[model samples]
Target: MTVSKKRTISDESRVFQEKWSHNYFFIQVKEKAICLICQESIAVMKEYNLKRHYSTKHAAKYDMIEEKLRIDKLALLMKNIQGLYLSLKTGHKDSEASIKASYIIAQKIVAKSKPFTDGEFIKECMEVSFEILCPAQKQIFSKLSLSGVTIARRIEELGTNIESTLKERISKFIFYSLALDESTDLSDTIQLAIFVRGVDSNFNITEELAALFPMKGTTKSCNIFNALKSTFNRFDIKLNNLSGVITDRAPSMIGKNEGLIALIKKEMGTCGALQLIQYHCIIHQENLCGKSVGFQTIMKDVVKIVNFVRSRALNHREFKNFRSEIDAEQGDLIYFTDVR
Candidate 1:
């Protein structure tokens, strides 16, 4: 029998040069190449085995490293883009403007009596109205504090702004007349309403409701005067600018000795103004005159009949329906009050 000889490759004849061979560490021992990365031996000592090892084992690591670098670079680019957008939109590189913008938006919301937590409002603005807002504006809204307390503070700020504006405008007026009236609301709380009519430097009329002072305790003439004085002092309203005072025929309002009008006149006299014209409300005078007419008996009968028709629920509904069916111009009788 003939014996077979084993084939062995020599290092001198082995082809180690390959494109992938440079990427891996190799060791040659006994004419066999060993791949350091995979810790495996190459028996035949050819480029194919090394290339196959690299493609199969270490190719995923290369791909992963490349993907990670790409993702990191992309993330950095996006960050720079966001920073550029913010710089372009807000006109500032800071978040301070967001606070002022939020307050302004809150002021409008409060002025319009909108619900403070209406997230749908912002959503609608983002989607429809303010969809063209720049990235900075979007970022501002995202970082804003729009809680209920924040809204409430904004409302107070709005009121302060309004008061400041009113004070400025009122200061431009040379003379102003105060129309004051006291009345009780449905809750039986006594309220003193004061309005001012003034002419500006341009001779334009400016009429404003000055105050709605609540009278908690005794509403005597002294208390009324004190309240008016406090309001005037708070607003820096000058007594020298007082031109006229008008009020209803209430004793506490117009009494010569201790009335609010008399006290104001006394203060004006001390300030050296000759006279502050006083006038009773024309409506009150007309109402007083109407009461003196000789139609009291007829008024009583009319009131009784009107009450019979309007006081009962069924009668009131039937009367209303009849009036509608007949196309009556005056559907219900006019309500009258006994002032006396």
Candidate 2:
């Protein structure tokens, strides 16, 4: 009889062999695998013995691995769904916060006539909140605050709301009157400021700034009348409800021949006319009277001193510090009035 050759297998096949110990046996402690049920070396790459071992000893473990894989897949899917939901909720909350904060900022900016792009103002608000707030509060405020575009948009929204509210109040009034004055701003643009005064069912008087129309061409009586008519039309205000009108003593406004008052009276006619009273502004009359008081010399000296203190940067700074040092109640030295 001839001797049989000894079988051999690959040494590289021994990685993690213990994890499959129920089916595979180790000839060495960490190497040389053999099938547990078949008693044959797996190193020889024998498929029959491995398949037999699977059928006999490792069937339960194979089922457990498949179940674990499915559970793991389901858990990962749920985690992803939860993350998506949280992301959407956070975005909605941030949007609401922006709108709320923008509303307040818009009102304050309009009331104070502050610039929308004032970075110093926005930074100051952020910095103060950052310093005073706790970590959670800081997180909440990170979404709130100002940007120039956001401020502009919110101002428009608030303006619409205010206009609607004023319309509601004005519509309920029994009678309403208009007061108008034209003035030149620092830019030399003539702006006509209009105000409406209304009496409600209870006779409560409500007064509000109606509009500021810029006069483009000649600001004659007819032009002023047209501007007023356009503004009333836009607001749906009836000229017949107007019970009174007030204006400054300027000749263009009160002159009998082609003045704003005369034009208004003519356009209104007799039927539309009620007790349409007209009055010159008392403050303007007093300002005119103050001119004859012989105080020109004193007023000129006061103006010169105020200009000296305010026009020079160093002098202005020193004066402010001096006032602070002395604990002055008023920070400024002069309150100039438009007496001219």
Candidate 3:
């Protein structure tokens, strides 16, 4: 047999042959090559695996551009957050300080981030800004923490002390007129205020607040008498020097047999008793007679129109513009006054 010259295998051919043989052996042995990206692999190369590998290991050049874009977007978001935070802090500085500080810190966080672009990010910043700007809710919590009964008792004690001090000073006046009135607050709490009218050294009517008390009931004459007597005793006021009592013509005050006037007269034996005088309050009489009917009606009508206009979006804008114009012309508008 002619010995054929041994054919030399090229380096690439040899390497290919070795790789093919290794792959064949691995398949026969049921072994697999692990993908670096996903950590699992099939016998054949997967497109997703290949892409992942390229992205993780060979994408350094493209990553620089992506990172720069991300940083710029983040910076923009941060700037917006900073602006919102500053606005909120400035708005609430008068109402709450601690809340403003927290908002400022949050704003700094957003500002420090690289620029970014995402509607969600902007929306989140806006939400946080609104939360910071909301009125302080902690005030209600603080008020709720106070003891209601204790607060009421303290107020009563203060009123009593004030009444006592006023009485002591008033004892110097030889003659004084006691004016009693009942009024109701917004909460409908009945309050009785006493006023003292006497001539001072300068011969001027020196009117002063003498006492104030919460009335038990509107129609209870006995309660009123007892309250008045207790107040007098508390202030060490002698019934002998009590000059005259001026009050409205209310049934509880001036009723014939069971009223405060009758009780005081019985106690002082009629001669040393308090002189009862009926005086109608001018303000109360005016209110009852509807004296400012036209003025009040006009004011109410104007307010209603203004409110109606403000309720609509377009009208509100128009109203604001009109208000600015009116303010500009206000200096030229002369207010007429009657000097009679």
Residues 61-81, candidate 2: write the lDDT tens digits: 554545567456434544565
Tens-digit lDDT track of model 3 for 196-221:
77643555555777667787566477
TM-scores for the candidates: 0.52, 0.59, 0.36
Ranking by TM-score: 2, 1, 3
lDDT of each: 0.75, 0.73, 0.55
User: What is the alpha-carbon lDDT of model 1 when measured against the actual structure?
Assistant: 0.75
The C-alpha local distance difference test score for the whole of candidate 3 amounts to: 0.55
Residue-level lDDT for 268 in candidate 3: 64
Among these predicted structures, which one has the highest TM-score? 2
